[model samples]
Target: MNKNQDYEIFPDKFRIIMTGTTFAFFAIAIGAITLLRTNFVWKILAVIFAVLFMIAAVRIFKELWVKTPAYVINATGVTDNTQKVPVVVPWAEMMKIEMVPNNAVMQIGILAQKTVTSQTEKTHVLTKNLFTNGNMAFYSVMIDGFKYSKKHFLAIFEELQRQGVQHNPKILVSGYNVGREK
Candidate 1:
């Protein structure tokens, strides 16, 4: 593909839907089972947990209904649409691309130039407290439901860097080679 060609990555709706539904189901089961407990504290705690899980499930399922590309990469920059507000990181301002693994989920963190913090001051959920090396980033997309494997995902950015795309930020991938299949 040409350097100017745009690539869009959409979330896997099926996997995400199933996960959301499973969480909802577990929440219901927990709430129901707690009814059998004699302790009031246990019941209250279980109810709270159930509500929180259900809320999370609802949010997760919303992703299934909203059909939008999570990430768009092109010659100009990488646009992250995963958050409420789209974050546009131009290649020149992109300082680093860090692949951080958390709880079996892989999140791609796009660290842009420190000056970009002015844009991140917005009240978006992803714009808060995302500090790395005294730099704030608003781009973090989860790849759990993506179609490509983790290795392929990393390769995409690496290839762009190798091709010497504009600025070509440093790509750092961690916790990917540990017991993970290609």
Candidate 2:
């Protein structure tokens, strides 16, 4: 690989990885609900869990779908297609970037702003406060349309670090679907 060449890691295998893991989990949860629905007392719990699983599955599907080119990353900053608007994180203000697990386990950082429902409107969902992220320092930017997980992601972050990105890298994530995967 040429040092001068700008490498764009596309999460080449992520789609396959997640489809098997996340989507499968959701399907299994749905299956469990079906299997347990026969029990009168447990039926309600099964139904609820199944619903939650289905919701999660749909989210995973949404996350895995990609309609853009490679994840554009460079010395200046990184850009993502998931973001509705363009986000430019200047290298000067760049802070540390790390990969984290998403879902309830850990807070998702460096990803698109999550959507929230509006309390004022009974039938409408509004954007939840995106600025107030969870206590967790960084969120793992989910890269879709891949067939695997570890390789490309690992390489991207290592490259960023090699380029001297420090922790809490000064980031400006004010965009529609911007994110990074390192």
Question: Highest lDDT: which candidate?
Answer: 1
RMSD of 1: 4.9
Q: Residue-pair clashes per candidate, as listed? A: 0, 27
Candidate 2 Cα outliers beyond 4 Å, as residue runs: 1-6, 12-22, 33-38, 80-84, 95-148, 162-182
Per-prediction TM-score: 0.66, 0.49
What tens digits encode model 2's per-residue C-alpha lDDT throughout 109-149? 34323322344631221222222233334232333223334
User: What TM-score quantifies how close candidate 2 is to the native fold?
Assistant: 0.49
Residue by residue across 72-180, what tens digits does model 1's lDDT show?
A: 7777677778556777777766656655554455555655654235544544334343432123345433333143455556665555454334446354333334344
